[model samples]
Target: MSTSDDDYYSDGIDIRDLPKVSLHDHLDGGLRPQTIIELGEQIGLDLPATEAEDLADWFVDSCSAGNLPDYLKTFDLSIAVMQSEQGLRRVAREFVEDLVDDGVVYGEIRWAPEQHLQGGLSLDQTVVAVQAGIDEAIDDAVRDGRDIRIGQLVTAMRHADRGLEIAELAVRHRDRGVVGFDIAGAEAGFPPSRQRAAFDYLASEYFPVTVHAGEADGLDSIRGALFDGRALRLGHGVRIAEDITIERSDDENVYVSLGRLAQWVKDREIVLELSPSSNLQTGAIERWGDEMDDHPFDLLYQLGFRVTVNVDNRTMSATTLTRELGLLGDAFGYDLRDLESFQLNAAASAFLPLEEREELSERISAGFEAADNEGA
Candidate 1:
């Protein structure tokens, strides 16, 4: 998504200049259009739009329509270019580069390997190619004096039957750049309970998972994500807002109550990876209102829930973690401390090991401290 104008226009400190953690970014959803054209030509896949600008605008317009099916169809084009090893590597590398340029300190890139096997590559081969690109980009960013870290959240499609295999893939590659596992795609009909085998396998392997829940469905889907999938974090679990009730009250105070599910999520510190733009575009928060102010991110945070901002799809949502944070700041009057809290939440919710997560938190705190000290 766009990060150029994400400066702290109202917050007094430029949000883009702060270090951020991206927990819910998607690899397939963040492809560069020019790269798509180049890669598409090799595979003989005809693009809907030949020019990069048209393609970019097309993505923006398609996603802006606020329909989940239409939003997902854009991936058909991105996935078309990512079927081969070379295409996967190029896309992954650019994805990392784009994150570095956007000032992301850490990110977890999630995508299903099954979608890339149309080119005769095995699932393992796809992981290898994507990891190679991530490594190359990491080394390049280090050479450029930019410190950034990324981990793969190897994902399986919820409607697909590859959950167990993909969970095994993620665990197998855990030490080799894969950090976690996830299930995505059509959350309405496919609940996490359907992937019981995968979650069981992942739990047995001590693997981390973050399931896409509460986006296309409601509380039952979220319950399935937590109870069945054992998700360490909720992918756009913004719909947990539905579980909260606002009771009428007099001038003294407004009575608010949380359903059992919402209470459990809040008490357990389950991180809600809320993507404001994507939430609006996909109608995740349409029940609240049509604007960013309608988002329950503020409510969740106000209620002491572990809510972290995210850019669900960099291309489709056209957002960065910084932009998401900036928008939240604009909507809720949040400052640097609030932004830092979201980063801390993401750092904690990361699929990385505890030690690595602690280090990430330290880095984030230090970065924010330096920014504040310098500004002062």
Candidate 2:
């Protein structure tokens, strides 16, 4: 194993050199520490730590509070600086650059535009600002000999009552840069059913939707996401493991029984955006255990569920998509084949058109093939 500043290696192969697709990454959760400092300074918002490194550490520490609500507290600082169009554009631009360093060929960055209205920017303006940043970063990365493609997943806060409005905002910008709709924040008390109007509207328009479910709640929430929201994908559906029953056979083989909910998800091939480290930190997998090895990711993958690795919050987890893959490899004894399969799963699950998704799969296959040949 080898570790560098921006890459991790197993068997002398740098994981960062492999093509990756990021589906569950959040814009507010992946900020650079220095960007937060400069933006916070301009806005006169007091931050937990002034130094970049310290602030980074603070995010990690604060997020390690063992619950979803506490983990979400770290976002307040990031969102504070992102109210202005300039701030939003800069952060979104740097976000793409960071993804480039992590070797992400395609990514979907999700953020709630309603939160950024404090700077007097309308919902459409916020989307435009973020799209501007994403475009600039793509051009810059291409100029520098890196290829990346990104789309926005316009998110609505589930705890709030503006789901229909946010859904409209996302649909309105679908042609501009938005690719999908999502409902994030406080998944316990507020279910996707609360956003039925939005989901209904989105369904009428045939817009893709992914809901944040099974992280703070359990199987019922997953049910709500599927039935009410008609989610094409699940954000951190780690807790869907709750619906499965496991038993050991006499031959020591594990026999698994899936409840109807889990069966539906598996049969339909619903994508589970499984963030291993973030799930552990937020106690999303506490029912299983308190460590990485205890995560249900391996079980889900072994059972042939559509499990894709993610860094749900990069700064809070102090990680990148590459690092997340390395950690999963470490915990689950995965090799290049397993890692490649995860990327292919993500590529297939991306909210792009069928043609675009096929192109992404081709890119991933070629990239992994080249990496394997180089290592050999």
**Per-residue accuracy of model 2 over 213-258 as CA lDDT, tens digit each:** 9999999899999999999999999989999998665674689899
Give the winner by lDDT.
Answer: 2
What is each predicted model's overall lDDT from 0 to 1?
0.89, 0.94
lDDT of 1 at 70: 76
Error of 2 at 330 (Å): 0.6
Q: Name the top TM-score candidate.
A: 2
Scanning candidate 2 in windows of ten residues, the lowest lDDT window is 1-10
Q: What is the C-alpha RMSD of each candidate to the true structure, in Å?
A: 1.9, 1.2
Task: Estimate the TM-score for candidate 1.
Answer: 0.96
Query: Per-residue lDDT for 227-340 in model 1, tens only?
Result: 999998999999998999998768866678999999999999988988999999998888999899889888899899999888999888767777788788878888778888
